[model samples]
Target: MTVTDQLSKVIDKTSRLIDLCAALQEENDLLKLENDSLKLSLESREIKKTELEEKLRVMTLARSLEGIQPTELGLSEKTLDIKQKITEFVREIDKCIVLLKK
Candidate 1:
């Protein structure tokens, strides 16, 4: 081949290489932007997960209070007795009022 033809081929190849390099660089920049976006999404999801776990823990603690028994306060028997007496007094008053009306 002639020297001029060989140099022309080399120049053509160099131009193709430059184009490829620019394309690759642009793709790299796009990928970097996507990677940053994914990282932010992961961080926000982690924060939401932590918040949900904390809320669940608080709800669990609150639910635990529902099982407390009056016997634990040492007044179960006394309270029951008082409730019985109140019921009997109410029944007696109701009967007396009925008799008085008649």
Candidate 2:
């Protein structure tokens, strides 16, 4: 083949390679964004799961305490708000526990 023909072929191949590289870079950036979004979504789900588990634990403790007399619970006769009772129960079971306010 003539040198001119070989040079033309190389130029065409180079242009295609550049275009391909640009397309691949754009796709890679999109994939990275999607991956980051998924990571955030997973983190949100985990936080929700933890919150639900805590609520469940508090509810379970409340149920067990229901059948027991107040004296058994060691709570004073002072008016016990339902919310306060749940908070107390959670604190009794787990020190340093933070209960989400309903």
Candidate 3:
């Protein structure tokens, strides 16, 4: 082949190589942006997970309080006993009121 033709072929190959390089660089930049977005998404999900765990902890603690027997609870026995007696009295009074209604 003529040297001019060979040089022309080389120039064509170089141009193709340059286009391929630019395409690869653009794809790399897009992949970097996607990677960054994924990282932010993971961070946001982690934060939400932590917040849910905290809420679950609080709910568990409230449930634990529900299991506490009034007698064994922090208040004095006298105070709790008085409150219980008052509740019983109210129930009896309610029953009497219902009977009167009937």
User: Which predicted model would earn the best lDDT?
Assistant: 3
RMSD (Cα, Å) of candidate 3? 13.1
The C-alpha stretches of model 2 lying farther than 4 A from their native spots are 68-102
Question: Tens digits of per-residue lDDT for model 1 on 1-101?
Answer: 99999999999999999999999999999999999999999999999999879765644454456466556656554564575568669999999999999
> What would the TM-scores of all predictions be?
0.64, 0.67, 0.64
Which candidate, 1 or 3, would have the higher lDDT against the true structure? 3
Q: How many Å off is the CA of 40 in candidate 3?
A: 0.1
Ranking by lDDT: 3, 1, 2
lDDT of residue 81 for candidate 3:
49
Return the number of clashes found in candidate 3: 0
Lowest summed lDDT across 10 adjacent residues in model 3 is found at 55-64
Give candidate 2's whole-model lDDT.
Answer: 0.79
lDDT of 2 by residue, 1-102 (tens): 999999999999999999999999999999999999999999999999998798668665755778775567775544344665777788776754444332
In model 3, the clashing pairs are: none
In order of TM-score, best first, we have 2, 1, 3
